[model samples]
Target: MAVIVTGASGFIGGAIARALADRDETVYALSRTDPEIPGVNFQHWDITEAAPQAVQSLAAKATAVFHCAGISSVSADDDALYAVKVTGTRNVLDAFPKARIVHVSSTTVYSSAEPHAELWEEAGPKDPSEFTDAYSRTHALAEQLVSRIRPDAAILRPAAVYGPGETMFMPFLSKISKKGVLRLPGGGRQKLTLTHVDNVVRAALACLDVPSAAGPFNIGDPTPYRLKDAIVTHFGRMGYDQVVIEGVAKDKALVTAKLGLKVKGVFKRGDRAKLFLVQYLQSDRTYNLSRQQRVLGISTTQHLIPSRFQ
Candidate 1:
């Protein structure tokens, strides 16, 4: 059976589509731009502008759709982010009513203040009033939209995703490690959850056969880590133990305030680096993946951050 993957040009979307293709499943990859993946049918269609014909054409030949397309960066405007994450999802659902959808979401939709607490499937608070960033807010709204369309749609809320081809944090880690000065936000005690690209792809593949695997499921390595440990491990792997870990909460705030003041005229303070850091530094987000394990049959694996410290 063939599966349609949106945002196949992106990291997570590309990984999931490649995983399916590796299993000999015909993958119809839909994106605004074509990704250079072998053995997959590549199609160009913008979800924001309502690609009904494009979606329908692919849905006609596919048994399932993996809706992995959405805005993830906090640097974009709220309206543009919502259009892609919320409106784009609506268009896809409208075009493919019968196709099973695996809606890719983020664990940030959950309250980050108390991450290690209780993350119950049928329990805990659902709405996130504390989410300050446009990315998380719109993603949460998109999840609501997907649920309204298909309550049985499989929802995978992965934690901070990392692996080869990751452009966001891995590079940052490398830069800081090479400098021998890893300045952590806050006290570096914030518990963070991360999902390997391989594990996330595996979970997406498992969702294909498990019709009962509907609703939101947290997919990540069961082993949560402190932000400090993650950085230390990354540097140590590169054979560098002479690292200085500093926590300058006041300095961070001052720098953020200066940047916010400078960029206030050009961009709203909502998208400022300070605001983004507040969410990252102050919040501790984690997930209980028992539901995912029970439903998707995913076994927990070791942390993906390279273990050998220098």
Candidate 2:
């Protein structure tokens, strides 16, 4: 298969690129940075910008595309987020009009509903006017644009994706583990829906082959893990010292998140802690994987804990 993978340098996108390359597929890695992987035809193209002549040329030759490029952080300003996530998606669709686009979306599109239930593929998107966070708002907008522009595009929404090459959440967890302290919101009892990087890649590949299976689908592990247990299990495998997981009040954690961002901005400059700490630590987000299984014919029950333990 000849494929074009946007954001091939990023964690999820890079994983997909590597997986496709492993299968000996002809891969066109399109992103602002080079994927630096063997057998990948790397092209420099920013999604927010117009489709460069080079990218347009590559897209013409590609059979399918994995659109995994977009802003994943809350640190980006509203303007930058909209430009990259919303406009960026529009540009990709325009550029790859012929390719079967597999869009990597997020579970954040769902609005804050009380008594958090399992989010399904059919759930409505968060109201635009109520958006306060740039990442969720822009991602939701980007999904809409994809559906509008190319309804056949397969949209895969994964939750708290973590694995090798995960620079955002994994590194944050590792850093806090090293400190021997994990200060979670609400005492870390919140159940988290985590999708392994491998499972997401698998789902994306399935989306490519599934005949006429287009639209939003949730991809996540079957087992829901708690914040504290997941952390302990993950860190233990990495040979980190025992981490003391403690939970602060949700209200206090919000205040801490606000203060943490401000203080980090003033002192640390570009810190990753300000990425999704507030929401991940505070909220309980899980998904109903029935649609994912029924549509993709792939279900992942892989635990985030180490191999030997499993």
Candidate 3:
């Protein structure tokens, strides 16, 4: 039997595909570009369009399709993001109607800042239009589509995933620092949940293992880390000495950030939703993982941040 993985070129999907191959599973990796994983068959698939003929051939042999393809950039074009996240998802579902779908989703689908409250799975499905960021809105809409069409699909909503092969989390943090000072909204005191990529991989695989087990699962580390602490730990280990961490008011930071720029009379599309990052840095976003732990039997107690992110 075979299991298919979309977006094998990405960090999360690549890691998942590698793990599946390591376990001796016949892995069919679908991506426009090659993910270059050994022991896996590569298939060219453009999710926004029809699935390739090869996908249909493997439908009978395929047990699951790990839908992990989507743009995670907040600055990406809204139309491009929607095409990949929303339209692409529809195509994947249609292509693998008989296969169990293990959808890798984001926690951004929810718009909550409640303190000390663990965000339950049912707490969201917030309208996609509410999010000002491109990635969040499109991902939210894509998730909604999955829920409506395949309610029994395994939907894993992971927080800002950081770990081995991560290209987003730490890099984004690193870019925020200017000179020796790292300024964040609210002094980076807000506790944010971060799910390790390995945990997410485990959750996705568990869902594939138990095809009958479905619904949404909030995947994150056992404890939330303060923004300052996470930043300090990441930089401190990387030998980035003499860096100072500072916190400022959200409103002040918003004014300082050059969100959308204008040249001549026209405005540049250089991330019109830049303020969303500032808001997230100052918010308390955590998750409740009791259901995941109880059902998936996956505990993310260790492997918080690996030394070398491969």
Candidate 4:
């Protein structure tokens, strides 16, 4: 049976597509842009649009569908995010009615408005009103769509996913690191839930074999590494042992971000640095892994650092 993977050009999606192809699965790679992997059959279709006859035909033949395509930018506006994440997801479900869907979701759907000691997969849908970011809010809305349209669908909620093709943290760290010194906020003690791209793929493929209604599972590494420690360890492995990590108080970091954001036009989302500092660096977000470990039989602890480091 064939496997359909949307957003096959993206980091996580591309990895999943490659893994499936390696296992000799007939893979249909769907994306609006260019294909990232060579072996798979590439189909051009944006999920936000109505699926054309050709796309529908392809979806119909799939045994499983991995809905990995969506706008992930924290800087994106609500309307655009909604169009792709919510409406696009609806279109995928409509096109592939018979295929077992493994919706790639985010743990950011957990409400950040209130303090939670622990985040659980069973923590029901978050109210969109609670979140100010378009990515988080729209993802919550899209989850609602999956629950209503395909309750039996397996939804994998991964924390900050990082690996070889990671476009976020590594670049940010490299850019900010000055002569072996890296600056962090909150003493870099903020706990982070990071999932390797490989683990995410395993959890996703596992979902295909389970009962269709397996619901949502929180996918994250078993070890909750402090932001600074994780990055420093990674740097050391990369032969950058001289890296000296420094941290600033969370409140001071917020002030710096606020000042940096002031001169910039608010519309363009500022720069990556501003976004990272304001939205991510100063916080702690960790999720419960018991359900995923027990249900999926896949512990994400296999690779905490990227493969290059290993």
- Each model's C-alpha lDDT? 0.75, 0.80, 0.80, 0.78
Give per-residue CA lDDT, model 3, range 182-228, as digits (tens): 77789888888888788888888888667777888999888888867
* Pairs in clash, predicted candidate 2: 187-247
> Against the true structure, whose TM-score is highest?
3
lDDT of 4: 0.78
Query: Candidate 2's error at 244, in angstroms?
Result: 0.9
lDDT of 4 by residue, 1-310 (tens): 6899999988889999998888889999988986757679888998889998889888657999999998756666668889999999999999999888899998878876443335888774588888766788888998999989988888889888877777655556766678878777776778888788888988987786565446888888887877776776666554444467787777787777776765564675464345444456656778788888788777666464656655
Clashes of 2: 1
Could you tell me how far off, in angstroms, the CA of residue 173 lies in candidate 1 after the best superposition?
5.1
Please write out the lDDT profile of model 1 over residues 154-253, one tens digit for every residue.
9988877877777555455454444677666675777777787777887898899786789988888877778777766654544445567777584565
Pick the winner on TM-score between candidates 1 and 3: 3
Clashing pairs in 4: none
Clashing pairs in 3: 187-247
Q: Return the candidate ranking by lDDT, descending.
A: 3, 2, 4, 1
